[model samples]
Target chain A: LAKTTQPISMDSYEGQEVNITCSHNNIATNDYITWYQQFPSQGPRFIIQGYKTKVTNEVASLFIPADRKSSTLSLPRVSLSDTAVYYCLVVGMDTGRRALTFGSGTRLQVQP
Target chain B: EAGVAQSPRYKIIEKRQSVAFWCNPISGHATLYWYQQILGQGPKLLIQFQNNGVVDDSQLPKDRFSAERLKGVDSTLKIQPAKLEDSAVYLCASSSRDRAQNIQYFGAGTRLSVL
Candidate 1:
């Protein structure tokens, strides 16, 4: 079974901010939350990852609270190209098990 | 600096027939993984390899699916008796443990259509 849960779909207008949240209540302490974006007919592309608190990169920002039960991926000023499936993955560091278990992604539709 | 590579971008085969997909990871990568992505769902890990040895394949259906990385660089995934439900995009990804993060880079994937 997948360790993460996300919405099946979301809608947003161009230039607006989009936030997608994922719940991983069973996340372990050594687990790190990573996000990826997948365009139609293409493989997934890495977005951002975080263990705790907040992690900001050029593409997006990841926010995690103290409980670490959930995390949010924030996209600033969304565009039509941002319309794609977003996946949240829990990676166990140093576990030597780098295999990723993906869940049903959240489809974000960005309209003009 | 080349990314993970997979061959036969598209394939169409009849059920019960055999098919194979090949992948070559980025140079110096010690870890390789194969995933199956059904339409309308996320990718599922089929198998994982660490330098020519199987590290994980609990999700793989051993009844029909098999994989190997002989040279610890290139790998192949084969299905002996394909089924209709086996139609999906097969993706190969590789990552380096030498780095601090375990970020995996994916290939374009091979779309298999089993009729």
Candidate 2:
């Protein structure tokens, strides 16, 4: 399992672009970076995932560099509903067992 | 097409009491996971199951907690003599085996409050 570090909190206004970065210096070659969004009183939902470079989805975008040591989740035109904790996970796909290790997560507050 | 389902959305019990949570994973999912999420913290993986066999349970408190996935469909998690520190949300998630990425679908979770 790889450990990830991210900002404790971030504040952004509605309709603005919010980028949350996570650092996983020990990321292995078989590891993939994944992001999840968790709202109050709800389970975390998958936002986006990337092995390297960038991957875009209907909800968010993920950017990874060549080193694979860090990745960023970009949310475009944020709204108040986007206020929630965002978790960055480094998961290994080679293993038969699959489970995510979540950190404290970055709490994004989309203010009006 | 249905997502994971969990029963007893909320539970309130006194200290030293026992509580059980049930989870029904999405159809055809081969892997299941149990996590514990405390207030102001992210969800922590408690155990992982592949069908009816246990994969990883390193973080599970075996002395007081027990879980089973009989017949490889639904799972039950029980905590004996709960403590105040055990007050947290228990989450259940599942994922398919064919997908290249480990994308897990989660349930609404069972919130346990130890009073």
Candidate 3:
């Protein structure tokens, strides 16, 4: 598993776009970057995942550079409900045998 | 479809006592994982199972913790002679490789308090 680094905390207002970056300097070729959102007293929820380039889903977008050392999770039009901790993880995507290892995460506080 | 289910959402026990948590993954998900999250910290993988067989348990404290996924569906995790440091949320998650993406669905988790 590749360790990830992210900001400890970030502040954003409602209707703003929030982007959290994760750095996995030792990412492997078989590794894929994944993002998960966690609110207070709840388990982490999968947000988006990508191996390379950019991947967008109904909830958020994930951008990976060519080097794959870092990735960013972008949340559009944030709302008070979007206040949560965002986690960045790099997992080995082979044969689906690998499990996720979460980090301290970036706490995004969305103010109304 | 229903999501992962866990019971005894909250538990409080004295140190050295035993506790068990149950988890029923989403139907048809072959992979299940148990994680422990301490306050202000990220979740740490304790074990991983595939179809009733364990894939990883290196992080588990085998002497005190045990888990089983009999029948390849529902699972249980147990801890005996628990220590104060063992107080944390135990999370159960399941994922299927049907899409080549291991997107896990998590249960609300069992919060354990060791006094």
Candidate 4:
């Protein structure tokens, strides 16, 4: 498994765009970058995933460079409810296994 | 579809006591995972099961924690002689191998407080 590095915390105001970057210098050929959002007293929810380039969903957008060394998660027009801890993970797709390693995610505080 | 289900949403016990948590994965999900989340930290994988067989338990404290999945549907994680450091949230997640995506659906989790 490749290790990931992200900010410990970030502060954003409502209606602003927030971008969280994650670094995975040792990312492998089959590794994919995924992000998850966790709220207080709730389980972590999948936010977005990308192999390379850009991937957008209804909730967020993931941008990955050609080197795949790093990726960015962009949340547009943030709301106070979007305040939560966001996790960045690098998982291998070569095997059918489904175990994930999580780090001390980036805590995003959305202010009103 | 219903998400993963976990029982005993909250548990409090004294050190040296035993406690157990149950989890029911989403329908047709062949892979199940158990994780421990300490305060101010991210969730750590404790065990992973594929069907009725164990896939991985490298991070599990086998000396005191044990888990079993019956008939490849439900699972139970037990901790005997719990310690104060055992206080944390136990999370259960599941995903289907049939899907190419590795998305996992997580349960609310069981909060354990060992005093």
Highest lDDT scorer = 1
Please tell me which model should have the higher lDDT, number 1 or number 4: 1
i-RMS of candidate 2: 2.1
Pairs in clash, predicted candidate 4: none
The candidates' DockQ values read 0.59, 0.62, 0.57, 0.59
On residues B10-88, what C-alpha lDDT tens digit does candidate 4 reach at each position? 9999999999999999999999989999988888889889998888887799999999999999999999989999999
Query: Model 1, range A34-107, lDDT digits (tens) per residue?
Result: 89999988889999988899999998999999998889999999999999999987743224444355758999
Model 1 chain A: worst 10 consecutive residues (lDDT sum)? A91-100
Report, in order, each candidate's fnat. 0.63, 0.66, 0.59, 0.63
- Docking category for candidate 1? medium
lDDT of 2 by residue, A8-111 (tens): 99999999999999987666667578788998788889888889999998889999999898899999999999999999877532244444567569999998
Tens digit of lDDT per residue, candidate 2, span B1-115?
9999998999999999999999999999999989999998888889888999988797899999999999999999999989999999999999886233679899999999999
Classified by CAPRI criteria, candidate 4 counts as medium
Off by over 4 Å in 4: A92-99, B98-100
lDDT of each: 0.88, 0.87, 0.87, 0.87
TM-score of the A-chain for all models: 0.89, 0.88, 0.88, 0.87
Model 3 misplaced stretches (Cα beyond 4 Å): A92-99, B98-100
Tell me how far the alpha carbon of residue B95 in candidate 4 is from the true structure, in angstroms, after superposition: 0.4
TM-score-better candidate, 1 vs 4: 1
Q: Worst 10-residue stretch by lDDT in candidate 3 chain B?
A: B97-106
